[model samples]
Target: MIVIQAKLIFLNQEDKQIVLDLMRRWSSCMKFAYKRLLEGYDRKTLKRDLQGMFDLNSRYVDDAIMKARSTLESARELGKSPKKVIFGGRDLFGKLQKRHINGKAYEKLKIRWQEKRKGNLYSRGDKSKKGNLNTRIEVRKNGTFLRINVGERKYVYARIEAGYKKNKRREELLQEIAESNIPYSVELKLKNGNIYAYFAIEEEYPEIKITKEKGVIGIDINAHPGNISWTEVDEKGNLISYGNMPMPELASGSKDKREYFRWQYAHEIIEIAKKKNKAIVIEELEIKDKGKRGDFSGRKSRRIRHSFSYKSLLSKIKTLAKREGIEVIEVNPSYTSIIGMLKYAPQYMITKDISAAYVIARRGLGLQEEIPDNYMKFLNALTVEELEELKEHVKKTVRNKHLKKKHLREINKAIKFLQSLESEPERVLKPLYGTSFSTYDFWRVLKVAVVTPLSPEKVPRDFSTLKELLIQGKWGDP
Candidate 1:
């Protein structure tokens, strides 16, 4: 019952110009839809509102509404510079792209990309103001080739053998695609002087297993404009290796090259996960302007928060993980950087980011960190007289005297504090005369949830629900 889907893309050169023309027309349609949105037309009513405007098919018009609606909504949510994601598709391609899964009324963007941002990249679409027919670009497929209707009964075909079936792994994918019964979608994309046919094929009866015993490879992502880091750890929270996998020192204006390098690292990580037969762990962080309105956190031109493309990296990890039969887990990112800064840097002898990544990996592994030095100072903050008074208070509480709940907790904290210094004279004496940190939040470390590292007596013994579901690709449906 596990349904998974992804794109199968290939270069389409025969009717590249025809598809490109359609893309431009699609962008025009999307802009018109954006104008209507700004005019207070809601998504549900766009069908009746802009009925004959684009002159596209009924379904294509719906597709425009969805795509345009999505484009505007995402721009608002992420505060991305581009409010208009000028993209196009119709009919089957429309259904597959899922241009707009969530529709909403979008606000006007002050900083819009008005074609002058990057030469003639978008100006051409603006000039091609004429509406396009629905049949200009059509999507169709059976068992052999994916056919696209360009114009005047002309069609372009993307053969499976010329694309995915050429690879050994993709050849298997083709077989699974042939046997699957679940629904699927296909698309055509024109990017940077190239055209790619994308098949969003669904995977039916997928096998998932959450493998135990095998240690996990916990990774910490540090995305920055000029500084990126990654750290790896085992299931026992033992450090295996760590360094900056997200390369920052790239040639200027080499976005594609930068992406290729990132793909390389992603590939290597998946290989590691596959070889070790373990799950991949990483943090889930969003990249956006979280500062006050119009006040993004950054320097003159360098925004640190915007630089953290943690979401994109996580997407790559998950996509590759699914392909390689590996598990991907995302954990909370709270305090990983702070804790790493305090203790991990000195202990691991690594740089700032690597230290943070080490802490991140251990956090993903569910390993409780050691008590920080500040906490120990706080534990020893109380004087001998105060300790004696606290001890007396504990005795008074047991004498049937009704006390507030806070009093009981304070008494328990006092007992736990005293136990740590019971046998050590230096620990008690130093605090008595020397300065110590004053705080009341010692439960931070004491109450941490932990999965004890595997040992002779610490193996996982619970498997009551193992047969119901399997993940990490260890076991699958027979």
Candidate 2:
């Protein structure tokens, strides 16, 4: 049978108290019935015994016990042994012959249980007790009106009408039902003085699969504007440019930090790829000087050092990728930027171009190419403005024409580093520096001086010595 999950909300205190009392009475009645059964009375005969003792009308008492037995049997099959069953003594055989309780009365009972279930009842000095008696109840929803009568005077009346609806709301509800486990189980909870009864539905796990082919994309993480670049290549190793998304200037200086934006964008892209059933290929980044002071001059260095958010972005991307079923492959990022620069080396500068071209040529011929430290020096010397200008130049010049083989190779190589940065920089950092450092650590680890124990009288007594020790320990420099 299809079961719908529904909740009941109580309107006032009077309604709430009435429901609580009904539950207590019902629980006591069930306990008495069970006690009789344990005393060797048959299940049906026990109901007759309860009918006589409670002065309950014979028909009502018999029906209540039978219904309680059925509920108990179902609960047992479902691996649950209910402590007690709740229903009205009078209503079971009276006018409203509903099988399962619902509506306002059910909600009221639910709330009373929730409030009395928490904590020890009495203080150490007082003998007053705590904790309400345990009782089990069921609610069934059939129509707009919830009708339940617990006893002769205690009854609950409420409406089960929709709260609000948007376009396609029912469709969304249907989807949720289809995806969810049928006959879902939830803990019925009620809070005193609260207008609504709460049900905490257990989370259901769904099966997930990746349905598309594998694709690799490069990501570059930054402090200001976090960027990710994608390069889609076909099976034949040919480049596909339509898939690339480059972020040239992601404002890195904002105090608000852009980790949230990066997480949102990455998840968006990853989800798109996941829905398409494609695997992602990414480059590995090696971030160095993670727990170190900024290299900028004077006070500006200190100020700039405080603004890194690299670690937060990487963490967010990794979590999202896992949820999307993206397979991230890490490739070495060494010399990617340098190689990319060399590939675009200007034709006007023949000597330098040839030197840059030679690096790609050797790699293409399956020969090992040595990376010079000068490349790093060159990169370090290029100001942020110059890097931006170079990016603009490449964008403007490389359009509407075929890129040279040398330049294309370099760009592909640099793209690997960018991919690594975008996908999982920690993977790259682990191999290169033996430690994963990101822009986020600038605030967490490097901003403070490491405390050193002193023999009370041997205080360093100088800020420079403290700074030197901190730098030597790789925390930061003055």
List the RMSD of every prediction in angstroms.
17.5, 22.2
Worst lDDT run of 10 residues, candidate 1, spans 118-127
> What would the per-residue lDDT of candidate 2 be over residues 33-150, giving only the tens digit for each residue?
6545435567667766675565444434544465456656654433333454333333333333452557887665554444433200110111121111111122234333333354
The TM-scores of all predictions, comma-separated, are: 0.51, 0.29
In terms of lDDT, the poorest run of 10 residues in model 2 is: 119-128
Model 2 ranges off by over 4 Å: 1-8, 14-139, 142-215, 221-223, 233-278, 281-478
lDDT of 1 at 216: 69
Model 1 TM: 0.51
> In model 2, what lDDT does residue 184 have?
26
- For model 2, state the Cα shift of residue 429 in Å: 22
Per-residue lDDT of 155-212 in model 1, one digit per residue for the tens? Answer: 5544444242355455455445434432333344443344444444433323545342
